[model samples]
Target: MTEDTAAGNTEAPANPQVKMRVLGQFIRDMSFENVMAQKGIAGDVQPEISVQVNLDAKKRPVEHQFEVSIKLKLTSKAKGMEDVLFLCEIDYCGLFHVEGVPEDQLHPFLLIECPRMLFPFLRRIVSDITRDGGFPPVNLDSIDFVALYRNELMRRQAEQANKTEA
Candidate 1:
């Protein structure tokens, strides 16, 4: 028997080691609009708000590194009025070192896990920006990363299936 095999270290040495880390976090873009400011609007009426969140990840050419970013868009319309109370959009990003994750599991890890780590910061930024824009802080609810990942996978699969059938 080979000495290495006898020692039971059968795995290949070059197999990427599994590790995850956050290297940095920063706001890549930010925009805030207070449409009603010109009208000298006051806080007499509560506004209806809508928010959208999107996540994207890209692998760096360097080994075991990735950039994960979350894009948040929020719009508040003055209730019972035609004016837009405020609009805020932010693209927040984080640098991550992820290694050893298997190819099959890597996509989910990047989309789900990496964002999971960066969410609180992104959420805080949204709230602060909204508050600074002269409206009540819009507190974002917790996101469902697993659901988002699964939905994205399903969408891709459906798209592929359509392409194949057509």
Candidate 2:
């Protein structure tokens, strides 16, 4: 109020530009089961696909380094009979070096931005796994990380509200 008001300047100081780097990435675990191969299929079949995504982040012992993991679970089944065609699950992780993010913004940054960076690799793995398992290759649609984060936040808030009411 003293110097700034006198100078006719009211804007706050600008935040530093965010800095990010992907140190490395890898698949921590993967399992693909081809049920159709084992049981054999005999009919005109329609496929239904379902996919689930979960994200986790942890700070590493090394400074400025963190680990973020994306868990992808996908399943395909025959439309009406509900016979499972195949199941593919993967846990992919990335090591990142990040700086200049505010403490309050870190959680969403890790969950959203980090996963976005790793999504293409995970998508390719899913496509490859399905193609190799003798099914029509699954090309996953792009995920909405911003919506995912907002939905998660709303869910947690509702959960907390329910607990308090109880």
Candidate 3:
């Protein structure tokens, strides 16, 4: 019998201790538009707001380092009105030191864990920008990074399957 079998170590090796640290965090880009602020809209107006969140990650040439960014796009339009009230878009990025994570698990770690670490600051930025633009603060709902990552993987797999069929 193999040494592992003899030792009853049939299970996979224990996961390495993954370490992550935030080296830097900053707003890469941001814009807020108060479209109707100058038009004197009624005080009772209630605008419908929609926010989209996206996450992306890239490894740097340096070992155990990665850059993760979260992008948010917010659109606000008054009820029963076709014109937009405001549009806000921001790209927030963080430099991270990730170590002891396996290569196979790196993508998920970057897309899920790293962004999870960076999301709160990004959300606050969106909220503050909207408030500073003379509107009520737009508090972004908490994001489900795991769900987002799964959905992205499914989409990519479907696209690849379609390409292969073609």
**Residues 4-108, model 1: lDDT tens digits:** 999997977696667999999999999999887966886677789888888999989989899999998888887787688888889999999997899999989
Q: Which stretches of candidate 2 lie over 4 Å from their true place?
A: 1-13
Instruction: Give the Cα-based TM-score of candidate 2 against the true structure.
Output: 0.90
* Per-candidate local distance difference test: 0.89, 0.92, 0.89
Best by lDDT: 2
lDDT of 3 by residue, 36-139 (tens): 87576657678899888888899889888899999889999988888788999999999999999888989999999988888888878877898899889988
Question: Which candidate comes out best when scored by TM-score?
Answer: 2
Candidate 3 residue 127 C-alpha distance from true site, Å: 1.4
lDDT of 2: 0.92
TM-scores, all models, native as reference: 0.84, 0.90, 0.87
Arrange candidates, best TM-score first: 2, 3, 1
**For each candidate, C-alpha RMSD in Å?**
3.3, 2.7, 3.0
